[model samples]
Target: MADGTVKRQIAAKVRQAFAPLRLEVVDDSERHRGHSGYREGGESHFRLTVVSDVFSGKRRVERHRLVNSVLAEELAGPVHALNITALAPEEDSA
Candidate 1:
């Protein structure tokens, strides 16, 4: 699939899986243009900021593991780097 399409799919999957109060998936490949591992079509690097009730009691390591599990296939293939900022709903407001 195309890079943007893959990114959108990843976003949709995360939204569905977490049902977060806020979820932002940014494609950060553009900023790395001409750099190693930078793809011309994008979707190489991503920053995911997700705030959800599901993360309320989870530890930081667990939260990241959950997200990593959700995108396991992608991480093994197309997704180069992922910066995850997971927050509980209560933490989100503060």
Candidate 2:
């Protein structure tokens, strides 16, 4: 996969799986420049902020797990690290 492709895949998969009211998938690979798992073209790391009804009653770990499962292929492939902030629609003021 190309650099931008993984980012698109993450966003699309999350949208399909949760239909989140709000979703932001940021590519954080640049910040990990000389660190481990840093790839040449980026898309190796990400930060996800998602607000959806699907997370209404779920715990932090549960929410992460749901997202992890949805992006299992990416996680096992190009994506090295994922920083997730999942919240219910009501929990997000922004």
Candidate 3:
């Protein structure tokens, strides 16, 4: 799928999986331009920040693993890199 489509799917999956109180998915592929795994259409890189109750008791690795598992299809396809910031709702003072 294309960049926009991938972005939409990522957002949809995360929203569905976590029911996050706050979530942001950023496509950072454009900045990678001609870098390896960077496609011309720019959907290969992403940064996701999520705040949810589900992350409350989880370690950082577990949080990342959960997100990675949920987005496995995307990673197996057009997505090349992902940076995730996972936080519990109680941890979010802002």
lDDT of 2 by residue, 32-85 (tens): 999999998899999999999999999999999999999999999999999999
lDDT of each: 0.86, 0.93, 0.93
Task: State the RMSD for candidate 1.
Answer: 1.8
List where candidate 1 sits over 4 angstroms from the true fold: 1-3
Q: Identify the leading candidate in terms of TM-score.
A: 2
Model 2 lDDT, residue 33, Cα? 95
- Give candidate 3's error at residue 3 in angstroms: 5.8
Cα distance off (Å), candidate 2, residue 11: 0.5
Candidate 3 structure quality by residue, lDDT tens digits, 2-89:
5389999999999999999999989999888888899887889999999999999999999999999999999999899999999999
- Model 2 ranges with Cα > 4 A deviation: 1-3
1 against 2, candidate with superior TM-score: 2
Error of 3 at 92 (Å): 2.1
Residue 15 C-alpha lDDT in model 3 = 95
Q: Tens digits of per-residue lDDT for model 1 on 2-43?
A: 338878977888998999889888898888888877777888
TM of each candidate vs. truth: 0.89, 0.95, 0.93
Distance from true position, residue 8, model 1, in Å? 0.8
lDDT score of residue 3 within candidate 2: 44
